[model samples]
Target: PAASEGLPRPIAGIGRPVTAQEIAGWDVDVRGDGEGLPPGRGSVKEGEELFVQQCASCHGDFGEGLERWPALIGGRGSLNTDQPRRTVGSFWPYAPPVFDYIRRAMPYATPMSLSNEQAYALTAYVLHLNELLPEDAELDAEKLKSIRMPNRDGFVPEARPDTPDEACMSSCRQGRPVAVTMDSRRFVQPGSGSGFSEPQ
Candidate 1:
């Protein structure tokens, strides 16, 4: 006899299958290759206005970022430096995701509040701030996908060797393990209650 022969049947009307329309509403993600971008257009000028109104509080007027907030512009050649500034221009490899992120989560206090046009405009404005787009540039799905970020070729494929299929029960290390200590005092601020005083 089948397993279901002795088991209780599934209860009917427990819940309905998810509808296509509901799934469509939640399927708003845009891919790096510009797939799933909604039909909308926005200019850098319009983006600037929207940025000042909605994003300046956290990202700053020029995408310079506020205190404790992230900076969006500059950092063109600092990726290899000791203090790398990972901004939209210096780090991001694609553009469509910019619009995706803004449309899905932004304005800090409010998420998913911007319309498609507004999201495009904001993406254009941020690109302009990073010197990736001209002042009069307008962006739509196609245009956004066509844009090649500065760091588009920065990333490389994973080259590290994969682990063996069989796990090692013991004797994994070939050398003695070295213990490294990190001084947290340098990271603590003078008045942050860490009790570590900075040298004058």
Candidate 2:
């Protein structure tokens, strides 16, 4: 059969569609608790090398963040103050999310290009730099999830309406409502009286 005869015509309004494989290639995302982490591992030494070559330009050689690129370490205990400076070693709740974010989008321009092992190494290196992990440690998906953050316990659980017996109106007071007043000057009067000329 001829090619045109064998294949159906494209949809009228549809353009070229993307394949599932293509989408999946760009959809790499690791969740907390290592849900979507790829099978790979990285060591602190490997991460330091990659960081110097790929990250040191924007972020300082020591992960201090060049100019305003954002520091990858330090800022511990800063979140307790009114004006907090958050960093990987400080306010982040989970360590796995950091690896996931880096793997998905990093190196600024070339995002989602690093291998799973490279990502793990970078995560380990950054954690070590921040003093969150030991220097000789290796980071894989499993251990990444297990790494607890200092600020993890600082955040409080979201407060929601409790059961009728436990609920207290005084403890959870809803704000008072405001009344709206219409101003005549805001609208324009129509010359021909056609709905006030839509208020010029």
Candidate 3:
């Protein structure tokens, strides 16, 4: 008996072409400054209830962050410190993108499972938790896009006009090594996993 073994050829372009509807379905990206937002409405009150059932397990009942999950509400003025808590209220720069992030990935146990209205509600709720939005604020594309982030001006964009690709080839300087601090202040929750971490 002879074994059938030989070099395997690469298979490319074997799948069917994507339809317009399918592409539209998956291309649900919401942009900053209020573009690409779906039509829906959400309120802080609606968000509070949904947050408890769907989000509280990891984010906690108050968005204080469960163990090392991440504190979503506070950290208003700690960005200047060496170790910043870096929550939505403290670090995020825009509002529309907040909706995008939540709608895309949240409730770790289930991502992209929330309806547009639910996503809007959750977005409003997280903002309400941070005290950025009023308790009765109604969130929509226009209003959400207009909300200002606390550290909106905290970032300074890099403009290396003087430095070119050719300059980098000859006189580029290496970056200094960064200091790593392992703080013991962090505690783990009962069922929270460790090792790899995901996007905030």
Best by TM-score: 1
Q: Against the correct fold, how does model 3 do in TM-score?
A: 0.70
Ranking by TM-score: 1, 3, 2
The lowest-lDDT stretch of 10 consecutive residues in candidate 2 is 188-197
lDDT of 1 by residue, 46-117 (tens): 999999999999989999999979999988899999989998999999999999988998977899899999
Q: What is the C-alpha lDDT of each candidate?
A: 0.91, 0.83, 0.85
Clashes of each: 0, 2, 0
Q: What is the TM-score of each candidate against the true structure?
A: 0.75, 0.66, 0.70
Model 1 scores worst on lDDT over the 10 consecutive residues at 189-198
Task: Assess the local accuracy of residue 90 in candidate 1 as a C-alpha lDDT between 0 and 100.
Answer: 95
What's the lDDT for residue 138 in model 3?
Answer: 87
Candidate 1 pairs with clashing backbones: none
Off by over 4 Å in 1: 1-15, 161-182, 185-200
Mark the regions of model 3 whose C-alpha exceeds 4 Å error after superposition: 1-19, 159-200
